[model samples]
Target: MAINYSKLFNRRATPQSQAIPGSGQVRNSAGGYSWEVTDWQRLDRFLILGAEGGTYYIGERDLVKQNHDAIIRCIKENGARVVDRIVEISDSGRAPKNDPAIFALALVTTHGDVAAKTKAFANLSKVCRIGTHLFHFAGYVNAMRGWGRGLRNAVGNWYNAQEPRELALQAIKYQQRDGWSHGDLLRLAHPKEVSREHAAIFRWMLSGQDELGERTVKRKVNCAERTATYAAVGELPALIQAFEQAKAAKGKGEILKLITESNLPREAVPTEWLNDAEVWDALLQKMPMTAMIRNLGKMTSVGLLKPMSAAAKLVVAKLSDQTALKRARVHPMAVLIAEKIYAQGRGDKGSLSWSPVQPIIDALDEAFYATFSNVEPCGKPVLLALDVSGSMGMAKIAGSCLSAREASAAMSLITAATEPDYVIVGFSAAANGHGGQWGGGEPGITPVNISPKMRLAEVVKEIEKIPMGGTDCALPMVWARRQKVNVSGFVTYTDSETWAGNIHPSQALRNYRDQFAADAKAVVVGMTSNDFTIADPKDRGMLDVVGFDTTAPAVIADFIRSD
Candidate 1:
């Protein structure tokens, strides 16, 4: 018997404008509401499902155009994929109180050897774990394979976590007290406080265990300690020269050959030397004025450390003996120092302020709308793949505490309406100790964010429902490659955290690019303040990792504008 992906998955398809399986009426910016949607079709434009029936929401033709090449490559390589279409349903009646609903659909091709491909595809359908029926599939065939099932489960758990403000208050109560060692007081604090998974990493850092290896750490420690010592003695430049001389005398045993050869009495040798910690400390008292001046320059040069502003006052006080300077008019040295540190705050804390955060979020949200904005009322279907990994705990920075899935749905629905076909997929690995159970009962995918017809605001509320879990980028990427929808590139909101799965990030990325060859691009957003260290591409491959703004919608907007 031939394997029928669409039939087996319980997926339904429609090429013309239609209502999302369970959504309500869609509303326009002008506040006019309608139930009908239009389609926008372009050459080589494609959309795929991240899940079996989950649909994409691509409302803009320009976005489809930007990623058309990538979509085609995905189709030629992987088959039986999923995609979404955000069908706007509008009516003259007042907006409904309930959120809109989402529907999933899969796009399949009959041209290829369906039986062989289906069999090959079926082998890849390993459920995340036991009791979880959701299966993994090829990227091209079911582009959005992971979205529907994966997201549904994640959002449900998040919604149940109660209010975040309350959670944060609880987190503070359980957090380690100020002076206690991170280990002694907080290793096992609840997951909400220290994050069960991240505690080990935090502990590792506190233990002085630099994962980059001891040699590098030792070198840096030595350099920092030595520099601190020398500056206290007012001989920093001389110390640098001495070190350079030692290096020049490669393989020499001792560092201070010249000082020793003089046969000078130990006491005659100025106590200004920095060999002993006591001597360095004494020097601070003996030559406090000189040390302050010298250290200021070094502090300014090295960007990491912030010397107390009082140091500036010390400089003026010490130099006052040589020249009279008025505090109101400003000193030449002060001007020089100010210029050196000018704009230092530009890329530091100020840059990370709320102003910057808002624009990025606004742009991303706009990208979601712009994607389908250019498309006629009728546009091609799209696939929305959202990451619900453990790192997404910071998904909400403003507004109501909505689940991640809800945020994705709200933005996705708008885009899906741009096209007649689409799909959605949410993904994560089995939780810690859950063994093989990833998609049912405890920790399952549920589209609570979706209503029969969801509005953009309702989508935000739904996003508050996505729970945090493992960060595995491979599953979604692989699925997209196999389910070759005429995908408008896949959009994933994430903090770039990924575990070692069946496929490494490099390998997964390579396989996708090799098979699809520019057919689609993956957009990753940094949801938290955490840094995402993506490994350098092994085979000269390039992918996009965009830090998402305040909302997932803004992330979509950024993706479209970049194209």
Candidate 2:
């Protein structure tokens, strides 16, 4: 028996039989053939997923530049569309950070034509929602090119557009960031004062002077100087004034009094006082939903949140509040990070440590799913294939403290909780435990014991216990076919670096389709922007989505259930 040496068998050629426009193939980071998504698709990924912190296979500088170049090309093609996309992502809070959106906006303003620049400038407030954002935008725009008149007015309009009270709060809360301060922006933009309040705020940011000659307004840095005369000052915004009063308050009692009385934000309080349990309890009462979620560990560490304590009850109530989660635009990743960090009872990069409270840990576990948009159950058997390869677990990352490995574990919970029937399996060539070389071995698929009954933090820990090896994303479909498992859909959480296998994932899916579950769909959630995807572009049954996107569950459900 002789095999035909000249004929193709294992690989599927790019379908030239059907002349699909804009269809092209590219080699993945792991030297596997995968479909290349369009530039517009790549731009959405760059804006939402972000290439910051790099990936296991790529360095940060090169990753960022690759995304940057894609965005630049998109800007050149249709700048107004690019601006609209930025506004869409930023305004919806779909991204983990708004830096990518603002940077994209900066590109439009710098290189886009007049209409594009106008659109970018007009939507500046939407993209740069706060002073920190505006400052970062200013720096990116300034670095690319000098600030032209349009840029100055746009920056000035950002300041002018805000209500004086809101602007004052921003000035106090985010006085400086990204090497640009309210004062520096004021000096550079020279924003027109929209009202007397605006004039006072402008003056306050620029100089330590007040609207009237009553007293010197202590610049935020000089917050140590608490003056009694400022209490009588008429023009100071109430929040700003309360922040100063809280800073100047002589004792914990006074600061607590101010926090309760004035509804002062935690940011307004002096850093030294935050170490106090009493101060944290006081701050918790008035903290915004997002702030409360972020400070959960801090509050717990400071002894403010204890089991069955009033603070713990309040925190639990808030964590379980779906309406508040939606209102705060809380992403599932945020809750996952909080759960992982709080469960460990230690901060990853700080001296902070806390004794994990069981109630709070459980609350965070539930809250991670609540942060995502609701999705109807697909009512089908799903195979969740996790890429626990060398690249996926070699480093810890999915933005901030949540590692790709941890994030994929948490992401699977979305399915375990919603879908009635689903199975999770980890695929790696080295996990076989047969002394296979790091990148050389037959792909192994191990059944992962994950269920909604388990805490997400626990699931994360359990998944980490699995040995990792080189990626072979095809293993999901391959395993399903080999084991004759009835699968309605396949969802792979991977970095898309699957090179250890002889067959491509797309071909594996097709082969499985031919046997059973012909209608089966596969969704590949690429955790990193390493550029290639295993899902065939022409195959309507397969999809490629960005990992960590808050709306991913809903999107996945819709796609899987779609006809």
Candidate 3:
């Protein structure tokens, strides 16, 4: 089941002609023109492979040499991609704690040529925001702590001087948006410039006493509101007393007013307040319709809030309103929530209940159509192949509840929604009559023509009906060639653990290109952290990408055009 790519792709270990240093060129097998393989390209492939284990076919020997210098070079060349890879790895929960932290610190402290280092720093600032703002704060801190002495020194340097001010500000903005605890903010502000700039607030946050007994919604609201007000006026002691009084008096209206005026970060608002009908009613009255629709999941999560009948009505009304759909279109989040509601039967049991209105369901279907308004149609027809193998049913996507099969279906739904002219198919090995043997059966795949007009939920339902069996990544190309389907591009969503076929996927692709369109391309959208890819290293027309990334559609489009 294992595939050693080092032996497969690299030259035999015999001393031969070596290219000039720093040229990054290697002579072809035919001893002809040299091809370039930059350090960044190697790093990109290594990341797309993800950490080994699960169903991946990649081994350690197949990867580029991972070391301090090599990692630094990766950051220098590809900034945000590297950081995003680290975050993704960390989020996957498959790697050791040290993995992401080591890479994150290297990204912050590593230097290259002067011009490159300047760009690296700029990239560092942008990624820090991504790490802190888009993901959980605790995760960001854990990664930053990877730089042992480097971290301490960097903190000291920034405190003594205004060093790494931009990075520090990004962290501050994240805290401001997320409503981190006072203690967390103080710890974050230990660096000199940040501490100096917000000295009053830091002192005030520290000066508060625990006289309020246990931390409650009223106390949190009062403290956050008072902190915001007093931080601006430098009145710490008075603010603390006021917070305590607000808590003692059970003055919800006063606390609500403070929260409203201070503009507390959404995360900072207490769950209790969010759950309160009065509080939600008041907040919903003022929030824009778009924000309400976008945050429907958060607002209606179990125990967070009872789905107010009014809120459900508002959502339905907005969905049905032609003018609103024309103006802004339903957001992807709305469609995703709608799908979840239907698939999980959330409306039947939860605090929220959908109206029996047939039009609401129709409107939801229209929302799916609206979501891809900005996605340009591909010039050439494409075929999307989804792997419905047994292994794909075994693991859920990291940090998500959806299994690989479900995620593949969802991603396929997105592709079908966007690509104007496309065909969708599900592939796996045909069932063997005897006790099944690996790679034993003839290649088999089933076509399920998904239409753009169908709702996402409907597409998912159709995808779920396909039977799961052993994986055969080569089946799609084989089927395409046999059926003579005229498609310029192929997109396969799988874990890349292709073991159930007579032909390798790369070879199958080559055969398809030779017999059919010589310029046909394939993109493998990997759904797991496995290192193995079916894409041939020698072919520029083939590519591998991580599934679920926001930029994946654009990457696929570009790859289709060979751009």
Candidate 4:
């Protein structure tokens, strides 16, 4: 009698993830395993998604150490390449926030070989574009390495490289951050004054006095001459001076006028009067996009964003403006967070409270859609398979309170809101601690009642009820194939902890393609900085991307539209 090999090695017999050796597979941070991403890919992920909040499977310290080890390894191999990658991400506005890129650049400055350090110094100005950036870089550098001659020169050159006006703007907008004030950096760097304007600016930076008034040229010039001279390189300084005067202005009228006339930034405004609706209204007109988004709750708390108010009109107009969104680099992730927080009428942190403006919440949701090009929706039948496993619910996306499970559901709402034909499903296996658990409670590829028109909060509430277990990324493809569903594309929004599948996700996808849809594509959107993906690198039909990346929705849509 012939031996039945299939019975001996039943794929579903094991409760734990089966990672095959030499099959280009490795165990993930979660019990499930995935095909490991490359070092370069890992670097991009770390630079974009810092290890601030640890995931459910890993703590922040461990996550940071793991990612840092990857960076160190990359530097050991070729530090110059790492520096160039940092610059490219910083310059291209690929990431929503620049801090990660800046942080990584500083790491290279401290850890990279001589060639990498040289490249980092050469591009310091590019990475640290603002005073806050410089301050952040300094904070990171101070923790890692001492202020050596190379570090000091780069710091000094940063001060000298800016035009006088630009420098003054930096002074006004970002007075201090990350415990590194301008005074500290100036005293440490001791940059030589490149021009009289620079000299006066530097002097005033150290002392409280406005040194521009004591300049010889200003004294020699007549009133008109002085006005013209100041105007030539003084617009920014004038705003700064006006900001100082506004701080002293006792009356609300005077303060409001100064804010409108000088176009003062909110930073220039005193904290005492931020609660004043009228003052916040004046600040609203010229508020940068990011500032406006952040202050939404505050504005609502102050009653400025009430129904049919002028401030409300201005906000709606701003959110709708495509050019403003692009120029501000407003990612939907930021918008979504703001919207969720505002809708909740409170913050996850702090004692602040406000009554949410329904219209503004709706506008923010709409703006989230607007960040992606007004491209025609990818008119394809796509399947959104979300990973709602225990690990996903346990680990939060870095920089956010929402876990991977919550964020995946929220992200899926975007596709449901856009595409005409789609199905939403979640996949997980029931293996509590790997004890040969069978299919008793396996909710493999369950259909989630996530409707297209459901509010985001409502959808989140609904998915939280569904039980979370082990992850099986391949279940979507396998279930769909069995159901005879002809999916144009499959997008698995997960933390990439897909270890519970009987077969690998990549193989399952290939098998599905061979049967149902020959050109079917699968996209793995990694929700955390777990440096592994279920998608095979060699497969042209599969793409992996960072979750909450501002460019992701557009990229995913455009790629799927090809079908």
Best by TM-score: 2
- What lDDT would each prediction earn against the true structure? 0.32, 0.77, 0.52, 0.77
Q: Sort by TM-score, best first.
A: 2, 4, 3, 1
What's the ranking of the predictions by lDDT, best on top?
A: 2, 4, 3, 1
Determine the C-alpha RMSD for candidate 1 after optimal superposition of all C-alphas: 26.1
Flag the better candidate by lDDT, 3 or 4: 4
How many clashes (backbone atoms < 3 Å, residues ≥3 apart in a chain or on different chains) does model 3 have?
A: 1
Encode model 4's per-residue lDDT on 466-555: one tens digit a residue.
777777777788788888898988999987877765677777887888888888999899887867887778878999987766567778
Per-residue lDDT value at 51 in model 2: 77
At residue 203, candidate 1 shows an lDDT of: 35
Report RMSD for candidate 2: 5.6
- TM-score of predicted model 4? 0.87
Model 4, position 560, has a per-residue lDDT of 86
Off by over 4 Å in 2: 1-3, 6-24, 209-234, 395-398, 430-443
Model 2 TM? 0.90
Tell how far residue 413 is off in model 4, in angstroms.
Answer: 3.5
The TM-scores, one per candidate, come to 0.28, 0.90, 0.63, 0.87
- Model 4 misplaced regions, further than 4 Å: 1-16, 209-236, 373-379, 432-442, 558-563
